[model samples]
Target: MIKDFNEVIKSRRSVRFFLGKNIKTSIVKECIKNATLAPNSSNLQLWEFYHVINDEIKINISKSCFDQPAAKTANQFVVIVTRKDLWKNRRDFNLNFIMNKFKDLKDKKSRRKKKNAVNYYKFLIPTLYGNFLKISGLIKYLNVSILGLFRPMYRQVTSSDLRVVVHKSAALAAQNFMLSMRASGYDTCPMEGFDSVRVKKLLNLPGSAEINMIIGCGLRSEKGIYSEQFRVPFEEVYFEK
Candidate 1:
């Protein structure tokens, strides 16, 4: 029961340097467990966390991140990977959420008509006979024609919005981990700056998993400096009747 949420928020900083001190495994586990409690689109939780602790593994991650000094300097790195196969689930979740919010969609017919037209013109035509087209420059056009037609067929049969739901859930979990770390007297950094392909290869990940973001956790170095960033006032960021 930490009461002062602002204290945690103020204390949380991107700690780039470390003192070779390791955060206990139990602490990490607890933090992760707290993160899993974060809400998601449909509670799909479509994310996996990889903890990199070995020196060589850390070095490789740093290299994949364009050789940023922070990557290698942190005590540990938590690599966040989302599943690509589950992205359709996310899309479905988003669609459903939209429907829920606007149950009386006055322009449903128009929207569907536009969607259908785009599908036909963009995806269906070229797919069916693109290879037969001899016009070298029009090959892409032919492919688009086929895709336009097939989009409707694919869209109708798709199942679940697991990706959107899961990624949102995963991000919530990540945020919890960061907040918990700060509350427990630790510093954390969320990083989206990395070569995803290289990271996937390094982790030997399956094609289904997509790299989302990396979070590093550790004690801050004495020399590390940070500036207070600004945020839009609450009145500007929120709306109420």
Candidate 2:
């Protein structure tokens, strides 16, 4: 039976040591499918999950992670990647999907909505995501900065800003994957302490692609969790505005 949502959240920990027991690959794949349903900026879905099951590849990835306990003992690894370079393809996909959905609707409101959606994918996406040698990004950033003085304007127009946008979306997917694993009686550790260059090379990823995180997955050992979970008091972080 699947665990309750609260139980899953409370049970999840950064498991540092894993039992030699194996986890079902199919379940992991299901969790990845759930991850794809995570909300992303403009539905671009600029993320990729590399589920490393091969022992040899996992070893190399563990080396890239400096053989941290989580990496060293993990039964498998899931690498989350951010693909800002694929924005154009994703935009086209959204456009095709939306156009097809509204194609049969001839009402004025439907036509207006379709037109807005088309403009968003065709014009706005290119304006924000299209960049030439960083020059265009700079120009767009400057344009937004000036426009903001007169009215509300989206200022995250540069390439770097867009990179952050994609990474945030990918991170959300990562969280979904981890929680889903917990719900399935598996554990995960999201690790950023890795030699990204080596990890990318091992994965044969392109230069434009970025590693959002590497997650170690397995059934936890008895001593997996090193200590009791701790958090800053909720009162300190919570705010009422």
Checking candidate 2 for backbone clashes, the offending pairs are none
Question: Which of the numbered candidates is closest to the native, going by highest lDDT?
Answer: 2
Structural similarity to truth (TM-score) of each candidate: 0.64, 0.98
Clashes of 2: 0
lDDT (C-alpha) at residue 177 in model 1: 88
Candidate 1 overall Cα lDDT vs. reference? 0.68
Rate residue 170 of model 2 by lDDT. 96
lDDT of every predicted structure (CA atoms): 0.68, 0.94
